[model samples]
Target chain A: MTEPAVTGTGTGTRAAPKLVLDNVVKDFSTRRRKTVRAIDGIDIEVGDGEIVCLVGASGCGKSTLLNIVAGLEQPTSGRVTIDGETIVGPGPDRGMVFQSYSLYPWRTVSENVAFGLECIGMPRKDRAERVQELLGIIGLARFADNHPKELSGGMRQRVAIARALAPEPDILLLDEPFGALDAQTRRAMQEFLLLVWQRTRATILFVTHDIEEAILLATRIYVLSSHPGRIVEEITVPFGANRGPSVLRDPRFLDLRDEIQELLTTQVER
Target chain B: MTDTSLQPVPGSGPRTRSGTGASNLGDDPAAPWRRTAKSGSRGRKQGVLFRLRDEIPLRHRILLAVIGVASIFVFWLLAATLWSSGNVLVPTPLAAWKAFIDYWQSGELSTDLWASLVRVAEGYALSMAVGIVLGVAIGSFRSVEAFWESPIGFLRYIPATALTPLFLLWLGIDETPKIALIIAGTVFYNILMIADVTRAVPRELITASYTLGASRLRVLTRVILPHSLPGIIDVGRINLAAAWLMLVVAELLAAQNGLGYRLVQLQRFHQVDGMFAILLIFAVIGICSDLALRGLRTLVAPWARP
Candidate 1:
């Protein structure tokens, strides 16, 4: 109903944003010759090293939006650019982690992490080193020789994250990475992700349905309305660095969580 | 010091020393109940034979299998001796064994076995090489599938047996026709089955590989092929039976030497015992090869196994 917000460069004084989605729209055509727009007229800018979260109800096309950013699916009409370059197809510049933890089951943990490097023709010695370093970072060094099937759900997701980070992509795109985990594990993973972000300082565009999770992890949150998905609100979190579970108890966090929850419920009622 | 030595060790209680210290077994309070529990478990282990979906011990399984095979032989013996009334038409077990020994002593068994095996190997190996390439292509690429779909659909229906006369006409009575017949019988099925297996690879794996900076070729070679390997072996295993059937058909129709040719000659001379021996050999070879392929599957694609 209104023009989506097109924010300026970033929180910092950078000349250009790290990632940009301009007037992004995606439509699917049914076999009966009817058109259904999944997401419409979206515009967003994620700064360098920023953890942005897109929050919405189911069928709000949040995952679709992430896929568009990952370049796995093309937008019906729009442009997505990273560092002033338009993305034509999937490349190593963007890393993706799906909710399903899409690790190659046949390969061991280290080999799965080394896949991208192998794709780029990296030397065996260097690939092994990078894979080892990542295994240590994920606290899964002991599981380096095990296959994906041998790991628990949380460990597999961690390996998936390490795999996406293997190529050292300019940005990380995670589509509800912990959506399948139990609530307790999800909270732990949230904390673990913050630590990983703090360590890698990688730019992230995260999607999730949990409002509190968005509030906890995101620098800025985008809330989308369902049934022809569209962004209705953008809230920039007011928090300093060094985030932890303690932030969940912060009074400011409570206020922001309520506000986003109300906004989502109103969208559902409409 | 002498009194301490006479006393039982402190940590080594009655239960620990009960097996060697017979006097402790009667003194221990829990010994009766523990013995009952152990006997109960032993009873349950014996009941495993009748329990639904329970695992049998390896030795028991082997014993059962031997009984199964022996029962078949017993039935054959009854049919030959009782029903036929001393006639050699059905050939008793001893008669077939004698025929087997005679053939082995004359070295005809090895020669015929080698001849049939080599033809099947060459034909099946060629089919596997060609089938895998074509199957992967057809499964991976839409255009390749489209181009080959209709022709293969029409050709597979026309039985390979119907083409034997044409094969002999085109390639003559030499080994060429026999080998060609085996290939014709199996290659089509291999291509279709393997294509189905390759198509079953998860789409997300391919997408994930692409995002990881892999090219199309690398994705096929590293991801799809490895993922589909177990199913491919299964397909190869199944189609090998068809290859053997075609080999026999080719040899039966025309051949200088092979198990199938030997069977034809034995039949003409009314050597029913020799025929039974050859058929037994065929069954044994078929089963052994099927098991070998299964082993190969486990070796190459351990991830596919449970």
Candidate 2:
């Protein structure tokens, strides 16, 4: 198949990528004294302001890869760098959203969002203002004083996103954030995420198993094979920044979706 | 009667309204069959009296509690009156009431109550402070856990009552020994319980804090401490009973005018009514403190479910 012409989206260019993972590998030691390889030799570059989705099946170590980049886990051999500096541990430069909404149960929506800012010693007034602004962007201003338990699952996930975004991290790492939501809510959240992306233009590294979700939200999609996960193919989504839900019916979207489905199924068979 | 019997069963018409949107029973051919089959047995009215895992109204709940307490009181009254033949071990309700009134009128009740409350407050407050510090340390860090684990394990097994004499020998016969005994009894349990609560804090929260650029101290103070606060308060509530137990033990051994010391005096005089009166005071105090701690938990951590 011929490659589609490069659009004006920021993902097309790779020069001085914002975040780079160089030959990253992770291995876990089992109780049987055997080393189990999780992901091997992953080299990925997410350009600044790009939405890159790592698509894979369960047990494919896609989350492990994201965690390595987030500095929540260390790679066994390779290195991850952002802005040319190697990441030794978790820092405020990268924000993370987990599948489980990790909002502090004790904190209100506003307090949860302000947590990171509080950690960085932002003054109380500034923290409140920043939290209010982010809540407005996420459209949860009315829920500022409400605890997480009071919000719906979708709303809580939005608050999680807002919290991660509060410190203004350079990169946003999301690990199957909408996996727990119902189908209808998931679609709504996908749109909300795109809206967030369009407004902030923050670089995002999203990991998910759903090919359709990948195609809908990603500027570039990296297909990963399971059982010692390795990158199998890198496909640039043909849609531009103006892409919408209508793209689901677009011929090109269907073709790319089928291609990824075929790639993943063949990987499982192998 | 015949027409009504032949008509579609009363409540089963709405029961078969499935999500398939077959709202008109006449339009669907299978609806009558479903209604007839379901109406025979499944259409019986369910009683609200014994709902499965359902909440009763507050007034009903209070009424039930009153009945329960009244039944216990009736049983006690019967036992005291009917079994009054041999030794008169159980005091009559009126006798116990009179004894309580006499003790109150003498003003000795206030003195003894004040003495016991002061000792408990001092020792329990000291233990809680120490326990929380050590528990947070032990729970948060491996080195601290290793340092304190074995010593605490060994010490907790030795009964605090057993150590009463030792405490007396070491700290002398003043309030020091009594306070020391209460601490010895409750602090170890508090430490272990609070440590477990701290350790139970979700790892994801700590990791999330780190990714948000929280230092270890900040994570401890901001995340773990607040998250564990409700659980710690729970631990305090449960262990307060132990503190009361130790208070009685400490006062029984030594010195002046505590409830436990008064109980010993009453026992010597065969004043079982006074003993029962003192026991009632203990019960009241226990219930009040438990309720207070529960209120405090709700106040500090409103996010936590009751």
Candidate 3:
């Protein structure tokens, strides 16, 4: 692993990488003893407060890369670091939002938000106050007493997001967050996520297979290639001043989308 | 509509006694008398019988009761008719009831019932402790599972009572042998049940805990144990009945005060009614044990019940 080049002095406060992946590789063995390389020699550095989206089609190792950073899985080689320190395991610094809305079924919405805090042995009063704050911010104050099973799909995802954000993690890792929802719900969630990011300014590594979603939300998009996934392209989009869903209609955005589509289609065919 | 206006013809509101040309019978002190008057004219109603019919859910309870009652009545009727025709194998219902009550009063029934319950409690506790520990060990490790797989499978297939002679030889014809027999019969079933269920726990849940900075020991303690508890309690319910069956079988071979021994003694004395009484006790014990185990399972593993 090479040290990331030290660039200009970071503006204002303390310095941190936020998240870094150094030459991470992963290989999975099926029952027949055949090995498939899921991620190969991936290295990337995401700065504090940066929203980096990993965009790719199916089996391109987008999810596998995110799982490695979340500490849900170990890479076959290399290391992942956060805040200039090697990540030993998952901690309160990096909170994960799974695509399945994996809210604890036995717990109410408020209790689900309190799970991470409880695991850290936070004081009861503080835990309750934090949960209340998150529920209010997520616009689920009225549904706090209900279990996950009783909520609609969109509402459940909100609760899941609230649960992941309850501990105030510096980095939020969302794995295809709105992938499980209907199109209308997906758009609603996308707007909700932008609102949340604006409010907290948390660094996010969002993984999605949808090109439009990446173009809509991401500050910079990293495109991944299939068949032993490696970075094929990195595009920096210029959203002049106003950044929102309307940015998708920009001519430059469409041109970039077409180029990425051609690149991804070529990789898939190969 | 005309029907809406005609709906209030009899009484509009609470009636007052000051005579507003309204039916004031409700406010009158003679209301009870009027109610009784209607009842008398309508023929006396069987309120108690009606309430009784409504209190119990007839579809379920009545069906069960009818089957039970019919079987007992038919058995007794057949016994009576057979005896009258000079066949004396089975006693009549009245005769059995008389003998059952008399024998119960002799203090022998209470002693045997107490003895059997105590033995079951002791043997079951021991077997549960051994079964859960071994089951968890085997279920958690692939190496341990592989080593014991064949031997345990073979042992489980062999009836535990077949080892009764060996237990008797080793522990003598005492309470120890009988209790040993009971434990042997039950522990194998519990081990296999617990291990099988424990092994089926979702691998994702375990991996999730581990990735959340939980150590291997912590993962086992916090995730695996809680997840497997419902399965363990389920197996416990099944093994409770098995333990009782083994206990009665064990006691049937010994010389002591147990329900099974009492039945055997009554058989020797040609006390067919007394034997039937002991058999009834056995049936009651089995049903009560099953119900008690089910209640315990529901209480401890509430999440298992949806």
Candidate 4:
């Protein structure tokens, strides 16, 4: 499989496109049965191991698109595929970490991280080892026995990420995962997410309304426009990979931040 | 909400020239909100007011409760025996105590207590089993709810006491009828409460589990059941009261060896002091059982603390 030609300043997308959204459309009916088009015809493919972000305003339905990909919601039209196979529903191949962290309040940190492993029927010994490794990486090993209520918002979200990755899915879907955190914690979590991505190499599809965040983490950005939401622009981030928080100070990062900001502000005719 | 620990307390240190540090504070837009970060307000939690209830020491609380109970007892003794000397209805605390000792010496108190406790155990256990199974099933499945919701709701409105004649006619004056009465009283109340809790289990947690590759059954077991655990205990705790309330109704008609029977028997003899003694016993039993349930709740769901 060849990489799609870089229409933006992005580097070459290599190997297979692990996730694909083809001609996706979603409609919602109100209490009065009035159909509101949440998403319009949209086609995008995530290259193998690529970090792709769908950035848009509130009504743009970026979350709806992510939900469809996660198999939590079915698209009104078109299909979503991962590794050339169509997804019918949520499976272990796609692990999702929601904005709410969604860590089981009843489970301790280690148990929450081991949840998917438990669901997939991993042996208890192996699951324990895997959970321990994940806890150490996310810096929650010391607090592994603590329940979600005992954890701060950021710590709970780190557990959420670790829990999502515990299943070792081919793709990780994060729906504004750091949205609830304070600014400092959100920044740290972004850095932590990159570290997790580097270790796991799972293809990520992160959805966010924050442009700066999209620029900081995403390899390629899909800017979605609202009012019958559709992709308005696709940007190839030139800052490349193996980045740290220092990359935020780069001129290219500033330019890209401004560029996405401009696209979001102005109405571009389709 | 301010981080008052970082703020210097007024008069704690020699005052510095105000304009000297004005330029440094000028750069921060949020510095104005920190003005309330006085030392006096340090470590104050948001949304909670300082109350006499909060500041009262625990030992004092216990002492105050004991004093309150003694005061009531003294008042009863004064009004019943001293002030109204010949009023038989007004049993003094000493007379009630004497009646309690008389019943205990006869061993009838222990027998009644044992009988009442056995019925509670049998009927309450049955209710718990049926309530949890049907509550979780009904709450998780729309079809199950559709099937059972209306009937359960309809039965809930009809007081368990109203079914006395039916229970007596069907099962006769036996332990089975009394147990059935208690079961009927507690089950549906528990079902509706537990089902509400199951339904209120967050949609997001369920979806998160599904994406983690959990089968429907796994989600039900690992997520739904455990999440609803505290609620189940809460239902049991609440329904314990309902269970005891029905205890009297169940024993009212033909209960030979229960606390309710002892109460009715004492009343027939116009032994007002004995009735008061039995009422005190009921209070103790009810309170002790409620405390036991609360202990069980703490043991079952260690994380759900107030």
Per-residue lDDT of candidate 4, residues B125-207 (tens digit): 99999999999998899999999989987888998889989999999998999889999898998888888989988999999
Task: Report how far residue A61 has shifted in candidate 1, in Å.
Answer: 1.5
**What is the C-alpha local distance difference test score of each model?**
0.88, 0.89, 0.76, 0.85
Could you give the C-alpha RMSD of every candidate to the true structure, in order shown?
Answer: 10.1, 6.5, 13.6, 6.9
The iRMS of model 3 comes to 3.1
Candidate 4 lDDT over A1-270, as tens digits, reads 112333333345554677889999999999998999999999998986678999998889989998899898999999899877888898877889899869888788998999899888999999999999889989989999999999899999999988988888888899999999999999999999888766666679999988889988888899999988999899988766578888899999999999888888874443
Count: clashes, candidate 1: 0
- Order of models, best DockQ first: 2, 4, 1, 3
Q: Who is ahead in DockQ, 1 or 4? A: 4
Per-residue error (Å), model 3, residue B230: 2.8
Stretches > 4 Å off in candidate 4: A1-11, A267-270, B1-71, B82-88
Q: How many residue pairs collide in each prediction?
A: 0, 0, 0, 0
The docking category that best describes candidate 4 is: medium
Position B229, candidate 3: lDDT:
84
lDDT of 2 by residue, B1-306 (tens): 133455556445554566554343333565555442332233334465577897878888899999999998899899988876567788888899999999999999999999999999999999999999999899999999999999999989998899998998998878999898889999999999999999999988998888888998899999999999999999999999999999999888886889999999998998988999999999999999999999999999998876
Candidate 3 Cα outliers beyond 4 Å, as residue runs: A1-16, A237-260, B1-100, B141-151
Candidate 2 segments whose C-alpha is farther than 4 A from its true place: A1-11, B1-39, B42-60
